[model samples]
Target: MALDVQRNWDVCMAENLERVTKESDQPKDKKDARETTRAEKPKIWKSEPVYLPDEIIIQILEYVSRFHESQYTLASCCLLSRQWYSAAVPMLYASPYLYGKNFDPFQAVMIPSRNLHVRDSPLASLVKILDLRGLVHQASRRITARLLGRTKGNLEAFIAPQASFGTNSFAALAKCHQLRILDLSLVSESPPLFELLKTVSRLDNLTTFRLPRSSGFSTDVNPALITWPRRLENLALSGGIDAHFMHGIVALPSTLRSLTIEHCPSAKGFALMHMLRAAVRPLAHLETLKLANLPRLSGSACDNVLFILPGLTRLSISVDYITPALFDFDVSSHREAIECHYPTLPHAESLPTRHQWTDGKQCELRTLELTNSGNPGVEDKVSPIDIVIALDEGALPNLRQVRVDKTLLWQASATAADVDALADALKEAAVQRGEDESTSTGVWTF
Candidate 1:
């Protein structure tokens, strides 16, 4: 009976081992499916996007466009959707900051194909400012002309390239009636003065015009024939304009507000003074005058500036052309000479009568900027004490701000007291004028 029980137990143990082996050999995927089936899985809900109004999107984009590096962000936004592209494209092309690497693609888009029949690019009209001053050899005359032709409809400001702009570009320039600022200061070779003036005369909307630094006002054209834009307000003259052309301008527009003269290799003190007396001073609205980098002017050449332009409110001149005597209250001789000619001056209707002139004291000058134009030993030309004495003497009653270059060393320990005195004087002046601290009169150095 014990032997029979042992055999039965062995047989049962073999069967149990076989059953466990079969269970283990079954496919693993089926077991996993069974285990997963026992648990509940979460359902994914597909929802529609919230619609935003076009006006709201545009307002958001306008806020983003205020960043300095917003061009890249705007370009990225163009790829989002049709609404985004339409809103971002105008802001992206309105003021394209062109450089060497990206100029080719810009030109391609501006002038899509060589063949004229190809549809004109709708992107062309969106450009408002086409500044090519950064490009050196990337553009040609033909390309500049074509670009101008494409963008002339709404081009408000154009900064010509250094080498590519020429007379060929004038035809398209004449058609840019909407152009407001034309800056050719970086141009290496100026186009013909006659053609340029003639082309620009038609732009009634032009307000600011800067002549090229390389402009050689050769005597081929008569200065009398040069007609300035009627609405021109700001004019910067540079380059090789000689005394004859400088003094021969028939009449500066009455709308001129600011005048800048610099880098004139041929300008002399007498010629400039004559031009100011004859052409510039008569303007009723002339307020700001800037002179710098004039090679021929002496240290005292501009001493009588405050005496000449009695109505001028702002003056920016290099220390190389001025002295402390600029603020002298005794302009008896200058007054006598100017009084003799004031009646005969053009635009006499606008000139304050001889009695209206300040009695040898200029009180209208509000801001003065003294720069260093490569002059040695210029630190001692004008000092803080000089300005303080002038203020005490009541020469510059309305003088609000004075800016000096670092070369003057006004910040040195030797002049610390003088600098403080100047600041205090300005603060007192500001208080007298009832101005707040933010707009207070002060001496600032750069």
Candidate 2:
């Protein structure tokens, strides 16, 4: 009985017409009383079909195609006219989402009798995003490679299938000049590191790339650091990445903007710190830094590098890795070592709550996401309170928002006291900033 506007429009119109027909056949007594009925509504009629330009119509259908969940309505639009077919077909083919139920039929259309007939179809050229992540054991690897071969020219963002994407697809993937985002994070059996690097390095236009989980890969594999793709801006490495790859990384490309290192067990405290200073610090454009689930990272190693990041804007680090010293406004030992190199003031006391480098550029930090990443409350660690104390003291002057896992952090009694201290710090910080706490909304209670 539930009516969907997109799917049931014609049916609803027919039902309305039928009701009007039924009303005309009513008895004289009923007709006299019928003005009170809901069916007595007036209609706004137009004699000619509305003349919508092709461009406007296509634009309207494009929005419909993206906003609607089910494609039944889109498929119906294609049957309306040749003009509609041309407009809706491209939108439909732009991102063909295939799952277990439709996988076989889609496979047949893409590769009929093992021959790719994609070129014969206009719809195939419009394919841009082929998200095969949902496909698990639905088709063979050969079928996937065939589709990639057909769509390689125009494909932009491809998240490979979890199970079936393999070596055969590499040739087609490398040839995709328009390729930008390549995410193989869910790949079950990772291809050899040497081959993966060689294959991906050929993609000149690739921007956002995520390496496969290291667990599915061989530990013996040592991939030599080569010239990474010129356009790569974001890189995420996970799954117990081998130390050789981490240590071998001389420096990320200057174009690199964001770097994420998570669940990397081999890269310990000093190892990670060394990697950051050597490989990461060289990138002038690096803005976002995320380190999490790094168990072996000592608090001191994290303390050494974070403050010196030239362009860090968003930092999400595990609470376990960072220490209270990070919030300290004046530490003479570090000042003498680090400050002397910069042309700026030698004393930490001269550093602004909102930091500016010697170049006179304001620090870009806007959001800080401090998380435990599931480490239990422990002694000799920086908690939420320490951060509030720092903020109140005018550290991280441009800091606007902070995110932490409240549920996990508040489970134990020992940490609960720290939460109280955090509350006091936040209140005091708010007061120090001359904020009208009573009027300002969105303040979290616990």
Candidate 3:
């Protein structure tokens, strides 16, 4: 019986071994089938690699180029493919405005060098404007010198303020033949600053220019070199500007439409009024004039100058003082001076004579803005009654819209009841004159 059992065991062991062998073979067969399928499939042409269309890649490059200092990353993209390199190279050198603190030394060297490569690239002709500010001091002067040497003709607008370079740097900038708009503000260094201005004046194409504070030009300096551009439309001068600068500005081509004078502390007493009258008399097409932070001139000085600008549609004057003479037909010495100086103005016509100037004339003044911070003992000491009288007589006659800050009216001590009374008076006057009272708009609040 033991022998029979042994034989049965042997037979079962053989059957189990055969079953394991079949299971192993089954796995091998499946593996071979997969291998055959992979081998039989046509090989994809991946060795050469399919790439995005050139136009799409170019678009991505253009998008990245819009960033100020994207040149490094964009240039690195060139290594991806010849097509990518070609697409990114031009945009890398496009109009770049360099400002703020992040601008480092490496970027300065790289930007101009990259620009050199870009100038040689298909996109070299595309760059137009270059704005270099505070961060330029970090760059090697050599890099700036090189850039100024290379792309001088293509640069249309150049803005560099408070840059640490010397007059030599500006001399390099002057070489740019196509320079049109130049803003050199906050540059305190006199040698480089003057040299830069001198160079700018020589550029026949220079149309728009901004000087740093009022100290840009010497008081005794002749402004004949600072001629107005036929294309020049906007001029902004700070209070530090000397009377000679004003003379230069007034002598500019009549094409000027906007003039902004701020913080002219040097223009104290009657000189401010004299400067305004002289500066504005020739600007026939003058549309907008802004004067702010002027401590020397009073509200009366503003009115005296404004009436001379008949074509003026928008006027903004922020002064510390307000007076009834500002709006009233007061024949004081100041009024007499205005009449004697500017005979064409309406204020001069009714001098000591209360003739209605607005009787036949269409109201040309569209907007009037008066703003003052009613700081105790700091701003104007005029009463609200004086301000109201000024508005009633001076403002209501020609202004279509008036914007008076609460601080200014409060300084004048005008109450809500006073405002209502003034509005009613304006309406009554407009009705009597057959004019539209609805056209009058006033904002008492800030």
Specify the highest-TM-score model's number.
Answer: 1
Q: Would you estimate the TM-scores of all the predictions? A: 0.84, 0.74, 0.60
Q: How many backbone clashes does candidate 1 have?
A: 0
Q: For model 3, state the Cα shift of residue 129 in Å.
A: 3.0
Alpha-carbon runs more than 4 Å astray in model 1: 1-47, 115-117, 333-362
* Residue-wise C-alpha lDDT for candidate 2, range 288-350, written one tens digit per residue: 998887777765567754455635878887767777776553434355325433448755677
Pick by TM-score: 1 or 3, better one = 1
The reply for model 3, stretches above 4 Å from the true place, is 1-93, 97-102, 105-127, 134-147, 191-197, 214-216, 224-226, 244-250, 295-300, 321-334, 340-363, 367-446
lDDT of 1 by residue, 419-444 (tens): 88988887787788787745647888
Model 3 lDDT at residue 172: 59
Most lDDT-accurate candidate: 1
**lDDT of each structure?**
0.86, 0.71, 0.60
RMSD values, in order shown: 9.1, 11.3, 10.8
- Provide the lDDT at 63 for model 3: 77
Winner by lDDT between candidate 3 and candidate 2 = 2
* Cα lDDT, model 1, residue 69: 84
Q: Predictions ranked by TM-score, top down?
A: 1, 2, 3
